[model samples]
Structure formats: C-alpha cells, structure tokens
Target: MSGIYIHIPFCKQACHYCDFHFSTNLKKKEEMVLALAKEIEMRKSEFQDEIVQTIYFGGGTPSILQIADLRFLIDEVYLNYKVVENPEITVEANPDDLTENRIIELSKNKVNRLSIGIQSFFEDDLKMMNRAHNVEEAKKCLEIATQYFDNISIDLIYGVPEMSNEKWLQDIETALSFDVPHISSYALTVEPKTALHSFIQKGIIPQPDDEVAQEHFHILVDKLSENGFIHYELSNFGKENYFSKNNSSYWLGKKYIGIGPSAHSYDGKNRGWNVSNNSLYIKSIQENKLPIEIEILTKTDRYNEYIMTGLRTIWGVSLERIEQEFGKTYLDYLNQQAAKFIEDHLLFVDDNILRTTKKGKFLSDGIASDLFLLNLE
Candidate 1:
C-alpha cells in the first residue's frame, strides 16, 4: 500500500543545525494550510488506483497547527484518496506544542502516532541546538503523551560537541524511563549554511566528532536491544509491532505522494518533489498547477537506491531479487564490489541476502556508496 506525506513548512523558530526547507515566519500559515489541502486534492489521481495505508504530517513542526487544522488536512486526504481502513496517521511534534489539552485533542483525533522532537533532555543541549522546548517540557510531554498514546516515537541527537559518552547514556536512560516505543536518533552533522556550521567555522562551538557519534550509536543499539527494542532501521528502534509504517514504506520503495513545499514523492520508476519556496508552491497550487519537478530513474539509480536503503534496514538486499530485477550483469557487479567488504566482515551474504555486520552498520551509507554502480553495466 502507498502513503501520503504532508510537509508543514513553518516553524516557531529555527534550529541551529537544521537546513531543511522551512520558514520561521507565521504570517502565511493559514494560506499555506489551504494550499497543502489543495495539493492533496490535486494529487489524488497520482494514487487513484492505489490504497493509502499511512498519512504522515511532518515538518518544521506539525504540532504548530491547531488540532482543527490538522483534522482539516487529514479529512482532505480521506475525501480525495482511497485510504485503507484504520490508516496509521502520524504527526511530527515538538515538546513545547504538546500541552495537556493538545495531547488530549491529538489522542482523540485520527492521528494515531506522534514522533516527538525531544532531541535531548538537557538544558545545555537544547540551548546549543536552539530547540524551542526545554528539558522539563521534554520529560513532561512524554509523561502526558504516554498516558494517551501507545504508538509514540521520540527523536534524540548524538555527538553534540562536549557531550560525553556518559552524558549520552543518561539521555538514553531518561528516554527509556518514559518507555517510549520507538526512537529515531541521528548524529549531529554540520550542514553548510547552517548556524552550527558557522559556529564551528568561527570556533564558537567544536565540530561533532564522527568517532564520538559512532560510539554513541553502539551504546544506543545495545541499550535499546536489551530493553526489547528492535533495531528495525539504521536510526530507528521500535518495539514489536511499533515500527513506523510511514517511514518503512519509503525504505521498501513503495509509492508515496508528498504534499507541500520541499516534499518529495517516489513511485517505483520516477521521483518528484515540490518547489522549495513556500510562496511559489502555494501560488501554483492555488492556480491549479502542480509546482513540482519529476525525474525518471535510470536502472542505475534504482539499483543504487536499493543498495543504500537495503544495507540500512533489517531486511537486507535480496540477491535473487537483484538478479531478477536488474539482471545477472548488475548482480555480478554487486557481488564483485561487495567481496572486499564481505572479506572485511563488514558485510555478509546470508541465504541470498546481503546485510551489514554490526561493525559496518554505522557506516552503511558509506559502504553503499562504494557498492554503487557508477557506469551503466
């Protein structure tokens, strides 16, 4: 089944390290919401024959919108698309927005899941990241949210400069104490043009060490694994039956439509994305034009994507399927390229599936790039 992703482009404030397409201005939020709904309706024919199994509201912060606004967008999806019964609807929220009444409202709505952005439960980390919420809001939101929702996921960041392994452990422990069913954690990378990068360049803040991030990842894996969490994806750990259906669909290369500026869509053969400029996107959609661009994936593009996603998840690259889909020639190239990593014990082929070893998990993306077929076979 396919899924629908709605991107909200407005934020209360900018995070220091983020470079994602968003605006801190609130003046256009109401108009933007309408444009998003219109885009949803406009793209119905793209998935006219498919059934939607998940509806994900992601953004600068989806919870910034009122529950009524969220419901209106969701209802538009239901009104236009052929949605499955009991679709998994997810909203990416921040702690500051999850008030007691907000949690109650969200729990009673079609939103069945929340991916809270509690990047760290420490005042210093919060300040460094410029997260709108504080440490107390992080813990308090989880306490109240857990009471209302069972399918909850929280975000954490690792390898912040000056954050020791012990401090990282405490962060994980605090999250564990709340018994969140899923967690998505990532290394604190400095993207060019972001405040974090500028800080590092100016010697205001030290760069996040890759070695420290690797150490933190292993700690995360071991701790969560011991607590009955499955390392379902590279950065995602979920308890049984709690894996993110919305995100899992993307890794598996299923069809999905993304609504709003800077959102992306992918079918098996082609990928599309909306304009990154919010005003342009809204204006185009309002004029009944889709402000998007599409590219047809080459065979090489598809194969490379499969390798990148395959190595990062529990489901490894299927050798037989590779041969079946892209032919034995591409399969042969993959086998030849993977031999060195396999010999290094960083990757292995088991029962026709190629998977990364625990040692190689942190470097899966790098390894996948090595396995990528640059010239068409």
Candidate 2:
C-alpha cells in the first residue's frame, strides 16, 4: 500500500537540460548514503504501515552507486522497516553505467527494474544534449540489460531542435527494436536557469518549437499504440503487466517515503520534502534532525491535487472519492467547471469518472486547473 523513494544526489556529469538537484563532485557520496540510511531509521514510523511494496532509487543517476552501497541501503530498509516480500525495487540509470557485470550485480541485490536514460540513439543528438553516453553505448546497455531484468524501462527525449521527424521515428523504431517493456518519453522543455535555456536565450542553440513538440507527441501516441504499448500516462507507455508501479503510486496519490537529499514524501494528507543541499541534509541528519519542510493539506488543497494528479492518468478523477473526501459541493463545482470542456470535446463524465478526451490530453493541465477550487484560505 505504501512505497519508498531514495534520491541519489550525484551524477557523472550534468546534462545541459537537467535542472535536477545533483552535483558532479562525489566527495560526500559515502557520507550522504550513510546519512540517508540514518534518515530512514529516524523516519521509519512516519508511515502507519510497515509493509512497503515499492522502493524506487530515483534522481541524479542512481546507477552510479557501487553494488555494495546499494545493497547496504537495502539491508537498512529490511532492518528498520517491514518491507514487503516481493517489493518492486527500481533503479534509475544512465546507459554508460549499465555494463553487463553491473546489471548482473544489480539483479543479485533484488533490483527488479532498470529505468535507463537513453535520450536519443544518435551521436549528434547525444552531443547536442551534452549527454554522457553515445548511441552505441545506448544500444549495448539495453541489450545487456534485457539479459538481466525483464522489467526494463528506457527514457527518451523528444522535440530537440536538431532532432528531425525522420530521426525521431528512427528513435522510436530503435526503442521498439530493443523490445524493452516500458518507455517514458518527454518533450525537451527548456526550463529557466538550465544551460539549455541560457543557450537558447543567447541563440547558441535554437529554442524548442511548440509545433514540432506537438507533432512528435502525436507520432509518439500513434507509434506506441501501434506497437502494443499502452498510453497509460501522458509521458509513459508500457506493455501489459509492465507499467511502472512506483510511478503509478504517485499519480494515484498513494503514501510514500522519500529519503536522501532533495527527495519529497507524501502521505495523502500532508507532504514533506528534504532539503536540496547535500551537506546541509547530511549535517542535519547526523544531528538526529530531519532537514525538511512540511505542508498540511486542506480540503481545497486535496480537491485541486486530485484534479491535477488524477486527470493526468488514464484513470482520470473519481467523483466518488471527491464526494467522500471533499464533499458533494466540490463535485458540483467540478461538474459546472467541466461544462465548457465537455462541449468543446475535451472532457467527458462517465460512471462518475471525469476523464479527458483524446483532444484534451495535450491541454489536460489547463483543463484540470480550470476546475480547481482556489479558495483554500
């Protein structure tokens, strides 16, 4: 019913498009891992149940850690918490780090899933994005990974300025050729303060075109569907029994404990996030204090959250849960707000489930926000 997320705050190199909390300096990695283990012991009773179904190693390339380091953390989880027998343990990885030996080592530690970061299968695209791995490395890793883990997911970035439609199609084809179980694709967004954003601003790199991104999006949907992959979420596609349980819990608003620096945790009612600074986080945990910020969820906060998270998935928002959690008035308000969208062929209500139509998926956030109750105060 509950899950855990551990953030690894180190990466071999920083990709220009990455805005994640990570550092290339690995001087504090050993200390940070030990600190994270201590934090887990401290926060063991945060969740009511001791049974954890999923343990996700996410963030600044979890694949960079040594096998023993990862095994030590898993041991700590077992010692401090009553982990479920068949827990889904996933590690987010980069292509270059996933050698055949490394994959075999990971498998021995009960790491059931591998989420590889293979943005593109072309050298030019990889160089343009400043990715550490090349196309050959990408293919080799996936080929080696399939031999070890059946539940493999690879990430792809679309809408890069240099990525032509033919190249994009080839990327999809290349992924399919790998026969990986899951694929998480995303548009290359230029977030503020990122090297990519600055490059675009300075005309050193062309800005991503919204039109091109949308074209790629449609292609993704069509191609993935044709390939027997379920378009389960806007950014995820998977075969039967291959959906990411760790990520699914997030969209379903399930409780999860996020450990390590810059990790976030939520328990349906309230949410908390660890500090992003590694040194500060380690220092605080060493002092037997959690470096975190907490927010208590209000009725309106819950309502709006339901809309935002639920509408993004194929499940959509449940009116029954809304009525039970937020009362009947909120449901009425949602229906009234959705009236315009329904007429515009963007949304529909069926069996008390408010879901987005095909035309609405692209603008799902905007539509969901329109139905949000902002008078939380």
Candidate 3:
C-alpha cells in the first residue's frame, strides 16, 4: 500500500535548528491550502492502481492550520485516490496550536494520530531552541491529547549544549509521564544556515556534542524499553501496534506521493521533489503544472538506499533478498565489507538478516555507508 504526504510549509515562528522549507508569512495560507488540494487531485493518475493506506500532514507546522482547511485537504485525497477504509491519518502538530478546544475539534476529524513536537519539557531548552510553546503548553497538550487520541507521538530533542544527562533523563521521564504510545527523539545537530549553527559559530551557544547525544540515545532506549516501548526504528519507539504506519512505509521503501513545496515522492523506481519555493509551487500547480523534478534510481542507488534504511529498523538488511534482487555480486560485496563490523560485534546475522547490535545501533548509518557498492555493475 502507498501513502500520501502533504507538507504544510507554514509556521508561527522559525525554530533555531529547523531547516525545513517553510515561511512564517500567513499571507498565502489560503492559496497554499487550495494549491495543495489541487496538487493532490492533479497527481491522482500516479497512484491510479495503488491503494493509499496513510495520509500524513507533515509540515512547517500542520497544527497551525484550521480544522476546516485540514479536512478540506484530506477530502481532496479521498476524491482523488483509492484510500483504505481506516487509513492512518496523522497530523504533525506543535503544542501551542493544540489547545484543549483545538484538540477536541481535531479529534472529531478524520485524523486519528497526533505527532506532537514537545521537543523538551524544560523551560531553558525551550527558550534555547526558540520554541513558540513554553513548558506548560507542552505538558498541557499531551495531557489533553491523550484523553482524545490513543495513537499519540511526542518528539524530544536530546544532546543540546549544557543539557546534563540528568536533564536528558528527566526529559525522557517527563515524556513517559504523558503516556504517549510513541516517542520520536533526535539529537540536536547544527545544520548549516540555521540559527543554531550561527550561535555556535559566534560562541553564543556551544556546539552539540555527538558523544553526549550517543549517551542520551542509549538512555532513551533503555528507559523506553523498560516502559514497554519497542525501538522499532533508529529514532522512533512505539508500544506494540503503535508504530507510525506513514513513516514505516518510507523506511520499508514502499511507494508514497509527497504533496506541496519541498515535499518528496518515491514511486518504486523514480524519486521526485517539488520546488522548494512556495510561490513558485502554487503558480505552477495553478497553471496546470507539476513543479517537480524526478530521477530514476539505478540498481546501485536502490541497493544503497535499502541498506541505509534497512539497518536503521528492526527489520535488518535481508541477505537472501539482496542476492535474489540485487544479485550475488552485490551480496558478496556486502558480506565482505560487513566482516569487520561483525567481528567487532557491531552487527550480527540472524536467520540471514543482518541487524545492528545494541552497541552498533547508534552507528548503523556509518556502517551502512561502508557497505555501499560504488562501481560493482
């Protein structure tokens, strides 16, 4: 089954570390929403034979939109595609926008899942990151969201400069306190051109240390596992049957269509992304144009992509599938490259599926790259 991802590229304010395509300007909000619907219907032919199983509203901040606007966009998907009866409709929300009234209204909609961006429960961390919501809003949103939505996920940021291990643990503990079924956490990386990067360069804020991030990750895993959460993906944990169906499809290399500016789409063979500029996207889509660029995947490209995503999840790289799909030559090269990591106990093969050891889960990305085939055609 395929999925449709609609990118809402608008935010109340820009976060320090976010580099995603978005504008704080609400001037084009009405235009963009309509454009997104048009784009959804415009791309229906692409998924003519595919059934959509998930409808994900990811964004600059999807929660920033009105319930009516969101429902209108979702209805466009239904009009254009063959959607599953009970599709997992998820909205990535920010705490400030999800007031009790808002949450109650949202629960009445088709959206069944809420991925709240709590980031942290600490006031200092929230200020450091320039989050729009304060600590109380974050806590309050979760308290109310849980009452309405059973499938809720909260994001927590770790490895912030000056954030102690004690503080990080507290963040995890605080998240557990909310009883969110899923938690998606990530280390704070200073992406170039972002405020965080500028702050680090000017000595305003210290650079986020990778070593600290690694420690926090382990702590997060151990704590959540103890609380009955499964570390199903590298940056995601969910209780049984609570894994993110939309995101899991991406990692599993399933077909998905991404709508709106800066959104990406992958149809088994080709990958495409729309133009990042909002005005450009709307103009083109309105003029019966699809502002997207596409590139067909080569065998090596597909193999490398699978290796990167596969090792990051519970379902490891399948050796037998590799040989059957990519051929024995690629399989042999993978085994040859993985030898040292296996020897170091960083990776292990079980039932012919290669997965990372607990010691190596944090380093899976690096290991996956070493196994990449360069000129093996």
Let me know the TM-score candidate 2 reaches against the reference structure: 0.98
Instruction: Give one digit per residue, the lDDT tens place, for model 1 in 61-166.
Output: 8999989999999999999999999999999999999999999999999999999999998999999999999999989999999999989999999999999999
Tens-place lDDT per residue, model 3, 1-377, is 99999999999999999999999998999999999999998999999999999999999999999999999999999998999999999999999999999999999999999999999999999999999999999998998999999999999999999889999999999999888899999999889999989999999999888999999999999999999999999999999999999999999999999999999999999999999999999999999999999999999999999999999999999999999999989999999999999999999999999999999999999999999988665
Computed on alpha carbons, the lDDT of every model, listed in order, comes to 0.95, 0.90, 0.95
The stretch of ten residues in a row with the least summed lDDT in candidate 1 is: 368-377
Model 3 TM: 0.99
Q: Model 1 TM-score?
A: 0.99
lDDT of 3 at 346: 95
- Residue-level lDDT for 106 in candidate 1: 97
| Clash-forming residue pairs, model 2 | none
- In candidate 2 the C-alpha lDDT for residue 355 amounts to 90
